[model samples]
Target: MQSCFFSTSRTTNDGSNETDQEGSNKLSKDKSIKKNLLHENIYTIPNFLTFTRLVSAPVVGYWVLQGNYTDASILFGIACVTDGLDGWIARRFNMQSIVGTIIDPMADKTLMTILTVTLAMQSLIPIPIAGIILGRDAGLILASFYYRYISLPEPKTFKRYWDFSIPSAEVRPTMISKVNTAIQMGYICLSLLAPVFDFTGHIGLDYLGYTCAATTIWSGASYVYTKDAVRILHPPSNIKK
Candidate 1:
């Protein structure tokens, strides 16, 4: 009688195992469908705006190199405005993506690199200044790669005013970056207006350019340093939490 009871229990367990396998298959199929749908919707409106800014970089560079400062300044301003707008739209509409975060900053860096190098070559800004800015930018890029390889965890929150003030943990861009960008744009606009309005005599374009360059170097350094601090403060061990 005991043997017969054990045989019945074994059959019951096998039936339950088959039911679980069937449920798991259905769940996996549902997840695959959802992933495909998400992949198709990656290109949101905010991302489109970012791509537009990336595309405008070369056009602005061309205008500036041709001595068309006014057009270049106008286009530069438009691109800057779009950068802000893209972030706002993404957050407002819940359209943010990992791709957008990566692409948006890359676009800004590429635009700044092109403009800064072109300006330096044209003698609008000093080469040393461009070198410093470029070096800092390059360092940040390398640091990013390092962080990824080490599997750095993301911050719980984006608000870090104290962290922004420090040079080492400034991995995240702050309002200072926006101000630096604005000053650079102003320098470019003033350089264009100097020939037309004879403002070079009153306010030299070279001086303005130098100021912008100084700020760029300072901000870039701050960012790189702060990022390092942040990494140290919250190392890989904290990732498990």
Candidate 2:
């Protein structure tokens, strides 16, 4: 009888031990899954650089407004360099994210627009020229939003706006756009340097400014004239069969 009782007790304990191990394994698996989901993917090198540039926007504006062009130019140079660095890291490391795509351009636009507007208001740069650049950027922003809204899954409610969908809004700067960006930054830097070094006697700053303005208008006009912008603005209508 004692032997029979001992055998039953051993069987019960064995089953309980097996169940505990299984439960532990399941808990561990759940923890691992959660860790994977919440990993620090956003803290990548490229994103960090982009974030730094974004933060520099306000600081650059403050310096420009304070009449401290020297420091402003310094920080602006860092912003421009980081812009390229982040892009390079993103492409080389395959660490691109939708958030990066949105934030990167946003940071650039913020920096450029804020500095230009502040300087223009101070009568340091041409107001009409700044208007053109700002206007172009504003249009692109609206177009991006318009394209993005169409890409979402439509509601089941009886509605037919369009059939096709773009995956995401892409910010593909054309060759001229890229050149314009470089010249734009260069002109801003030179403008800032003019105050520090006194270049009123020369027309270098004016020359660069005119070039930047021309490129800005040309790039913007190219977008409008090209079919790309129109297609993005007006998606194809859904044809119900």
Q: Cα RMSD to native, each candidate?
A: 9.0, 11.3
Alpha-carbon RMSD, candidate 2: 11.3
Across 1-241, the per-residue lDDT of candidate 2 in tens digits comes to 4775443322255456555666689878777654443232566899889989989999999988998888998899888899999999999989876557667878888898899888887677878878887888898778766656664334422233221221234455667777888898887767667778888435878888888989988887776666554232222343111
Per-model TM-score, in order, reads 0.65, 0.69
In candidate 1, stretches whose alpha carbon ends up further than 4 angstroms from where it belongs are: 1-41, 148-171, 201-207, 227-241
Native-to-model Cα distance after best TM-score fit, residue 40 in candidate 1, in Å? 9.4
* Most accurate candidate by lDDT: 2
In order, what lDDT does every prediction score? 0.66, 0.72
| Local lDDT at 195 for model 1 | 50
- Tell me how candidate 2 scores on lDDT: 0.72
Please provide, for model 1 over 102-213, each residue's C-alpha lDDT reduced to its tens digit, 9 standing for 90 to 100. 5688788888878877776777666877787687678867876554434323432334212222112213465667678778667755654565566653456667767877
* Candidate that would win on TM-score: 2
Alpha carbon lDDT of residue 133, candidate 2? 78
Candidate 2 segments whose C-alpha is farther than 4 A from its true place: 1-43, 154-167, 227-241
